[model samples]
Target: MTDPARSALMSKVKGKNTRPELIVRQELHALGGRFRLHRKDLPGRPDIVMPSRKLAVFVHGCFWHRHQNCRMASTPKTRQGFWNEKFDANIARDQRNAFDLQQLGWRVEVIWECQTRKREQLSASLKKLLVPPENHR
Candidate 1:
């Protein structure tokens, strides 16, 4: 690939609701769950925000968010240390964000990119999350 192309790819690599996020959002909407998307004021800008239920979801990419023990999360050989540091920071920040949100009384759920690979299962799981505990019983 050309240098400009590589640069463009890196530039577009952001930390936000990507394809997986959109997929989850679509499933949740179909399940009758209404929520906000990427609220900047929120601690982590959660991908899904259900105020009445006080639940926040962070749809994480397995590679970018570093899913522990996941094969797809392996760091690139080139600049290994830099990738490790960045991935570690992402995990730490995710923990801190979830902790802060919980302390403020918001329940947090993390969905991984690998999970999205199993769309049917992920859809069912997301439905479970969206459903109120009382309603489940």
Candidate 2:
């Protein structure tokens, strides 16, 4: 694709309220998970925050966050150096944010974009994640 075309496509990509994030939010709500959106006070402004549970959720796109071993994380044919640097920076930032949140006594969970593609699976996963270990029995 041409530079202009690529630029337009990239611009259309949203940083918040993305389809995956919305799907995750809906599933979480259906599972009775009350949460807040993008709490600015938090280290990385988590996509979903369950204050009572002290949990922070980040809905990350596989490509942008470079999900390990995920098909969607494939690099572009062009701009190898640029993409690598960008991906590295994103990963570093994600690690820093998770570390800071952990230090603050908050649990951090990452919900990948591909994981939200199936409603049933997403629901089941959310249920498992939300349940406290003590209540597992």
Candidate 3:
């Protein structure tokens, strides 16, 4: 069912504008928030970076980033060990990246593809990222 040509074409595609990225970006825009997309100076080149708030957002694919307890996360029947290590490394690195950003005094937000795919919950989840409760008013 997979088209070889399309698959080959898709493999070359990377960076933001992915489905999850677009979804999150659209919702964030609706909230009237502005951010830089993938600034190279950052360690991870976070998907959405706001210098004013020192905030970073990462839009993660459930399958690729190995979302914990997600059905989409599956090891290939072949080379299971390699996949496992890669998945574990990704998770570990993700943690490290967020920790490093935090150490630099940045507030990090991670949006999982699985979470964003839920249409009913996407707005609320995205809003939570863009707006933290204000201490005043």
- Which structure is stronger by lDDT: 1 or 2? 2
lDDT of 2 by residue, 1-137 (tens): 99999999999999999999999999999989999999999999999999888889999999999999999999999999999999999999999999999999998999999999999999998998788746766
Better of 2 and 3 by TM-score: 2
Please report, as a residue range, the 10-residue window in candidate 3 with the lowest summed lDDT: 128-137
lDDT of 1 by residue, 40-119 (tens): 88898898899988899999998988888999988777777988899889999999999999999898999998898888
What Cα-based lDDT does every candidate model obtain? 0.87, 0.95, 0.81
How close is every model to the real structure, measured as TM-score? 0.89, 0.95, 0.84
- Arranged by TM-score, best first: 2, 1, 3
Candidate 2: pairs in clash: none
Please identify which of the two predictions, 1 or 2, would achieve the higher TM-score against the true structure: 2
* Cα shift from native, residue 36, model 3 (Å): 0.7
Candidate order by lDDT, highest to lowest? 2, 1, 3
Off by over 4 Å in 2: 133-137
Off by over 4 Å in 1: 1-5, 133-137
Model 3, span 1-137: residue lDDT tens: 25687569758777677988988888878878888899888878899987876889999988779887989877667667977898899988889989888888888888888888786698887666666535314
Of the two candidates 1 and 3, the one with more favorable TM-score, higher being better, is 1
